[model samples]
Target: MQSSSELFPVALMSAELRGDLTEDVYRLKPANSPDPSVELVLTRLGRFGQEGGRGVPVILLHGSFSNRRFWYSPRGLGLAPYLARAGFDPWIAEMRGHGLSPRNQQYRRNRVADYARYDLPAIAAFVREQSGQVPHWIGHSLGGTTLAAALGGHYLGEEDVASAALFGSQVSRNYWPLKVPPVEWGGRMLLKRFEVLSGSWLKRGPEDEPIGLALESLRWHGLFGRFGDAERDWWAGLAEVRMPVMAVAAAGDLQDPAWACRKLLEQVPEEHRHFLLLAKDEGFSDDFGHIEMLVSKAAEREVWPLVAHWLEHQRLPLTTAALEAVAL
Candidate 1:
């Protein structure tokens, strides 16, 4: 591994106030990335007067077909800002070709493998250098899955992460059709026709995704499949993860259901593993969907505070009605 300065040359893009909060954007160019031209954009939100998030660094990653905006809006009304207001230094990262991040040389070949192996380490190192404290990571949907891959593959360690919290993320959902050779072959062949999956056309979100990601999923759910690459078995690695972690799922999250999310949580094999299911039965008025669990007004009241509390204290209480095992 290279030093943070040698590996990631950063450019300060902007430092301005969004509402009452200060937003500083930086573009990091890493020399060791598989795709050499890759540039990742990180946005850190802070208060007008506070310094260095009071030594509590938080890194937030968005799901597929989304960007940093998923965690925050330009008007500064989102989880990132909410965390900032609560005296936590929150960094929001955009994936390749999403939001402020520009396309790399092999834009179409970008996969979670590349992100876990090449991108996340640099991001973690950069955050560590900028803030003297190890940061806690938070991810939504694909972001959470990528975080799992990074941790399971040993791309990150206890030195880099204080803890991790995943929202609306899971890998247990089975695509039975992909289990057959013929169906998997046909699906790959059809997906190869396009360089990217159009989020706009699919009405999934605001950004497009490399088809390599789609193809990668086929392999994961295919025959003899596991959640890992050729180099490491991420599923097996999950049991080896030592840091505190949490996985939250929504009852109405059809994309990544509560049952599937719980499966991911169960794999960690940690004594402090926390599982939260946002459902009407859990005291939330709504059985929040995949997107709603993070980006809705309901989440602002019920979910954001829990995240803050989790970062402050490692274990959640086992008695909260709104959370599976919520708050300190």
Candidate 2:
């Protein structure tokens, strides 16, 4: 592994104040990755009062066809800002070809494997260097799935993560037909015809997805396929993850249902792991959908506070001895 400065040359793009929150944006390029064009954009948000304290660093990963905006709006409203207002240093990352990130030279060939092996570790290294501490991670949907891949494959170790919280993410919603050889081949052939999936047209979100991502997912769900990459079995590898984990699901999420999310959570052998289902039965007024579970106004009142509490639990307590040590 290379030093953070060597592996990722960062460009501090801009900094501005959003109401009382300060937002700083940085672009990080993996100088060592085979794909030279790949670059990731990370946005850091902190409150004016919390600057010197440097609150517990938290990174938020957005789902597919979305960007940093998913965690925050132009007006500084959303979970990222919410966390910052509560004295958490929140960082939002945009994956390749999404939001502020530029498309890699092999953008069309980008896959979750690439993200797990190359992009994530670079992000972790950069964050650790900047913060002087391991950061907790939170992801939604495909973002969460990629986080799972990184953890399951051991791309990230316990030292890299304080904890992980995944929202509406899973790999267990199996499609049986894709398991068949002929069906798999046909699907791949059809998908290969397109270079990217139009998120705006598909009504999924604002950003388009590279066709390579679709193909990679098909291969995983295919009959002979498994969750891991070339080196390890990701599903089996989950049991080895030692960090405290949380998996959240929305009852009305037809895309990735609660049961499927639970199945993914169940695979993790960590005793500290937990699952939360956002359903009417769970006291939420409605069975929250995939997006609603995180973005709705309801989330502002209920979900965001839960997330803040969870992050607080994982943070290292600041004892007087520790403060004195810092002074020395």
Candidate 3:
């Protein structure tokens, strides 16, 4: 078993490579009408053994209110190098309103649909242009939802993804709803009204803002609790996906329950779909919750090994008999 400290060196190396990496960050100007541009930043993981590997490229998408940097932490949660060592070139995307990518200068409204329509498509195109491959996407939370939307033909004309994996995401309304405090509801309603009228609202700094707003959005939109129309439609789009998918969730996750995650897997059209649930006692002692599945100390030991194994199985094109045997 590799110690957490052993992982730090690799992470440091990765950071150094990223610091020197030179990739163009572009502002995607929409076609036809002059709509506000969407920010696009692209960077490559340097000189991995799998640079010329035969498997489809892989891209990592972060959840709401997060940027690509979350995946590069010195902790073992960073999946890029691990994927690289397993023979896949990894790419990370920062959606608008997180990290270096923010809303357009002319338009600051934060709509989830914008992620599907612009950010996802732009990143896909950029990956294809740079790598000459239609990549497989792996997303967490809102990132997963956005990818499902894109794959379902809600945004792009024809799906270019060969396969996808969603971690800690679900579409059931009965599961968890946003938990906004009543005291904040009035303030939020007023803010929304202001945004509608003024075309933009105040942008809170990361430290200055309270988690209540984010929590409320999830509650109101049924992201954390019950399923809603948007979530159902999102899951319906999953049925349209022709490629294989892997869905995972944590057992103790209050945000997305384990049963809900398995339910999501049951709806997948692909027979090759696989589901995984990590019990809270598996290896983590910090009471690893929802987001920690991707960013915790136990991730390398518990979470990613499953992902690595699945990817390896996928590369060989296992037969049903072989898959069943492997499962057994």
Clash number for every model?
0, 1, 13
TM-score versus the correct structure, for each prediction: 0.95, 0.93, 0.69
Sliding window of 10 residues with minimal summed lDDT for model 2: 319-328
Candidates' lDDT values, in order?
0.88, 0.86, 0.56
Tens digits of per-residue lDDT, candidate 1, 60-128, equal: 999999999899987778999989988999999998899999989899988999998888888998988
- Residue lDDT tens for model 3, 38-131: 5544444534333454345688887755666666553323776566555666677766545555455434354545556566776676567656
Ranking by TM-score: 1, 2, 3
Residues forming the 10-long window of minimal summed lDDT in candidate 3: 3-12
Of the two candidates 1 and 2, the one with more favorable lDDT, higher being better, is 1
Candidate 2 regions with alpha-carbon error over 4 angstroms: 1-7, 314-328
How well does candidate 2 score on lDDT at residue 75?
81
Q: How close is candidate 3 to the true structure, as a TM-score?
A: 0.69
Runs of candidate 1 exceeding 4 Å displacement: 1-7, 321-328
Checking candidate 2 for backbone clashes, the offending pairs are 179-223
Better of 1 and 3 by TM-score: 1
